[model samples]
Target chain A: MEKIKELDLPSDHISEFGDLVKQMHDVDVNMCYQCRKCTSGCPVAEYMDYSPTQIIHAVRLGLKDMVLSSNTYWLCLACGTCTTRCPQETGLLEVMDALATIAESKGIRSNAPEIAKFYETGLSNMRFFGKLYDLGIAGMYKLKTGKLTQDMGMGIKMMRKGKLELLPTFQNQGEMRRIFKKVQEVEKKARGATDK
Target chain B: MKYAYYNSCSLRSTGREYDKSLRAIFKKLDIELVEPKNWICCGSTLAHNVSRLLSLVLPLQNLAEIQKEGLDAVVVPCTACYSRFKTAQYEIAENPEMAAQVEEVIESRFEKKVKVIHPLEVLSSEPVISRLPELVEKDLSGLKVVSYYGCLLLRPPKIMEFDICEYPQTMDKILSAVGIPTLDWSHKTECCGGSLSITRPEIVRKLSRDLLEDAKAVGAEAISVPCTFCHLNLDVRQEEIEREHNVSYRLPILYFTELMALAMGVSEKDLLLKMHFVDTDSVLQKVVAR
Candidate 1:
């Protein structure tokens, strides 16, 4: 996904953001009463730039800049802790995901760029190779994060055990690239409908 | 009865130990697991974080293959993969349009019928473990184990549709079937900093330290887990966690299936206990004597 160009502000930004999420898969943000049940149960809330509850609150108010730029977007483990406890079953993981796409396409940098780098590297690896490569993803990620040599020892150990394949293992890369292309086309068609 | 195995990327590679032990234990119990001809990654956190459609379509395509093979269920051992599978089913089932969109991307019909079962759900099934008593050759009678469910097994309760989101007991029961006395610990369903073990090790170090410390306090000689990421963080990185935190924790993390494989007299060669970074020799000495 490329950076979405800055557009003229919509009359109701919160509704626009909420509508975008709801349109994606009918996410019912209306049921979220800001009870903070999601926040209290989140494992990484303490480390997050915005609490899960706060992120939702930001969403309710349409504070996309704050929500998108926060570290909480990147730190979520998608462990389903909050989603399990949610009385309305809002699926906060999906919310974080929706916010992340908006953040990424709009060229909003994550508060946790290294975390963002890991995801970017991982997704790129999957798109290019048809599957996640443990060694390859780590190499690209270290280069992106400039944290090379951080886990060199452990990498060597895994390599010795033949866990890290030097080359891509899955043979479905051609099909995978096709699928990736088709999805991008679909997303483009979806976005093309928007006035942005 | 037989089911298709979605032995994910990690399971096929880095988590090969888990793959061996899971297949070994299931074989011992007379259950068969068939693999779909060409399954792919679950897209994990990466796909979902990138594109919603990519996340749903990846798992849907895998399920489509399993369904075409006539398997109604696919046993997924990796917790991360399981989470994506369950989430895909949950979201797609709730929205027919989204499911159709995902089907378009993969160019296949996804009926969304595959049940994503984890190892605990399978091995802890009454019919399966009921046969364990007669099958135990080595009898891991006196070993103290703490079953670590980690985060994904039981969270997001509605979507997962099994076990208590917090304080799950399935892992405990699976360990019991293998003859180890499983402890009830407060940290059973806690986060092990999961995939962030790569993005941020210090976070994993702190979280894993707490889990190891709790297991130690409860007199657990080993920590048994079903997730590859959990095993990687808890076992392979324990030494670093211990050193960084100024503590000594000599805990050996075992894939739950490895423990079961041990009790069923599967050889150390099959379990590959030596592959673990933490010394598993001490823990296995007990199982060997049994």
Candidate 2:
């Protein structure tokens, strides 16, 4: 069994952010006995460079770079199989989510460019419209990531089948703007806290 | 009771039959489905996986509109939408602080009091189930249907609470009510690799093929489910599954509502079997023949 390492951080970075991580540790991260049950059950591990167990280990060690840049961070589908199967009742998925939040804050880009592009477009679409328009978001993602030509045939077929509507069906633009403003406010607060 | 019906993305596109059948069934049961004005996608699996906060907020905004209409509950026909809505509801109901944060994020006073019900729960209620036999003009005496209750409908059952997490009997009970003999099968609550159907086709193919083969092992001629995403995965992906596995298995997958509509004397054409990639004609013929 691999010995668990305690998180060591520089004095400057030790504040509410560290406290936030501790609050997330309410899920009994210490209960993980290196069973590797999470790794075995993870569907994405086959394609991921690091398994779920490894991601947990990295987070436990506070190896920010290793945890953030790993494929497992972006690849987890949060199926809850790991959490369900954990003998020690470790909320593995929740821990991964908190880690992912940390990684996002750090602006650690994913090796999978498509995944990041998808998130950006999705967030932008939600911010602008207060809802997701799949066709529009997909188009925007493709344009931004230069993957437009990859699945042009599928897009053509979808359009032909009336699956891809050209225009978004927005009921109230005012409501959307209000929601976007609120999100911006929340993000601003979090950013301020991080800066302090 | 009236509900703001969210047909969701899949039902609007690939699984439109589910929408048609659900509306018809709800109409007969005296349940009024008030379609929301200019509704958008529920963010489904994509939004939830990418950003949890954003996903919760998007669905909460939609629910806010439903609340504004004075409806207590929103009837979601698509399983993914039902699961996501139910999940958001649970999260909001449990974590008041997170709810407040989400409420702050959306700039709306969300009371965290709305209930999300899947169409199956509404359709398979005691009153609805009791009225099934009387409503069935055509007896599905011979259709060997396997009720596939995909992962969303069951798991994380703490949120869904509609049926048994492992072996749900709602669909089977409804099928039996309409005189359709359901196959006693395992793998009912198995994962279909869902949205991963797009992101990871090979994995989905292997998982879906194994599920199809398991259903066939139990002598199921067709499979029925309450989820549009599962329907798309099991039915449309049959071609890809067959290609990848190097085997031919053309088992038609029907939305549970489609079968209910059929038993209630709805015409096959009206049920939109034509929209399905897998032809259900052979299975329907067996039922007619019996």
Candidate 3:
């Protein structure tokens, strides 16, 4: 109850966000019913600024700005817990994914910058190397965040333990490059219709 | 049983012990796992989190490659890769438009027909567990473990659909067959902070502290997990967690396959159990007591 107040939902009506989510995935955003089961079952709900149910409600009411700017979806573990436990099978996790996609393209400032940085570094390295390069991604993230010595002790030990490989880890980079390009080409066409 | 093994990128690199132990155990059990030609990453969480289309195409590329080799069932050891493959399976089945787009993007057809089976599903089946006497060289009678099946493997029951989402017991069944007693614990399927282990260590420390504390509360000498991420989070990060939480927890987080390999009399030196950051000396002392 108190948390919902923090949303400061817009006074005027703009329920299009609800309609928009319904357009994105198979889940019906309107049928949320405010059961609160999704929020209760969420693994990272405590860390979230707004609960999953609250986000769903905000989306249902078309509080796009409020929902997009919030950190709830950013913190979601994608553990599939809330979706599994929902009586109506609301699929909040699926909705969260769709919401995150929309949030990024709209230039919304991420409430969780480290997560965005991690994704940026990871995707860049993954595309370049044709697979995940553990050391490369970690090194990039540290530089971006300027947390150079963050987890340094464990990082040093893992390097010795062979947990961190200090090289480009794959071949066939040309094909991976193609796949990355092809995804962007297709994503623009697919989402450009539903979004814009 | 034969399978086109898709070890994913994690198992190929950071999770070598998992791959090594799985191969060693299956070799003794007479199960064959063949790798299809030209396999690639499943795009991991970055795909689904970034573009739903990449998540669909990347896994489908691997699935199509396996199908081309005529293998109908794929053995996915890494749960993150397995979940992406399963999510792709879900998307391709319901959305024809997305399906056509993915097929066109990859320049190949995804028949949408391959079965994505996890190793736990295969190993825990009655047929495999029932035949353990012949394969067992050292029964794990003295070992006590808590089976941890973190998120991706079994949740959102409609998708993962393999084990119980909240309270999974497949690992318990599989481990018990080798004579190790798996105790009941509430955090069996709890989230271990997922990829946030990299993006947000604070979240992982709290979540894993609960997991380690729960496992200890249940009298587990060691913890067993199937996912590489879970093992890394629990095993690699335990000391940090212990120091932060101001507690003493020296739990050996073992991959389920490594335990299976151990029971088959594979030596500790060969399995590299000692390489674990949170010393497995306790588990080693227990399991090696012929």
Candidate that would win on TM-score: 3
Best model number under DockQ: 3
Q: Judge candidate 1 at residue B153 and give its lDDT.
A: 73
* Sequence-dependent TM-score of model 1: 0.93
Best by lDDT: 3
Full candidate order by DockQ, most accurate first:
3, 1, 2
- The interface root mean square deviation of candidate 2 comes to 3.4
DockQ of candidate model 2: 0.30
lDDT of 1 by residue, B1-290 (tens): 79999888888667888999989888877788998986777798688887888888888888888988989988999888898899889988888867777877877776547888987888778788788777888867678899888877777787787787776788787677667789878888888999789987888888888899999999998998888888889887988888787888798899988988888889888776767888987678787544
Which of the CAPRI classes, incorrect, acceptable, medium or high, describes model 1?
medium
- Candidate 1 lDDT, A110-151, residue by residue in tens: 578888778888988987877888888999999888998998
- Candidate 2 matches the true fold with a TM-score of 0.86
Runs in model 1 deviating more than 4 A are: A1-14, A193-196, B288-290
C-alpha lDDT of residue B58 in model 1? 86
Tens-place lDDT per residue, model 2, B1-290, is 78888866567666678889888877877889887764555667666544556557767878887887888888888777777787777877777756877888765686647778888777688777788788777768777889998777666656678787757898898888888889888788777777555445566777778789999899888899887667767887787678767887789898888888888777777777776777888767865522
In Å, residue A188's CA in model 3 sits off its true spot by: 2.4
Shift of residue A165 alpha carbon in model 2, Å: 3.6
- What is the DockQ score, from 0 to 1, of model 3? 0.66
Q: Judged by DockQ cut-offs, is candidate 3 incorrect, acceptable, medium or high?
A: medium
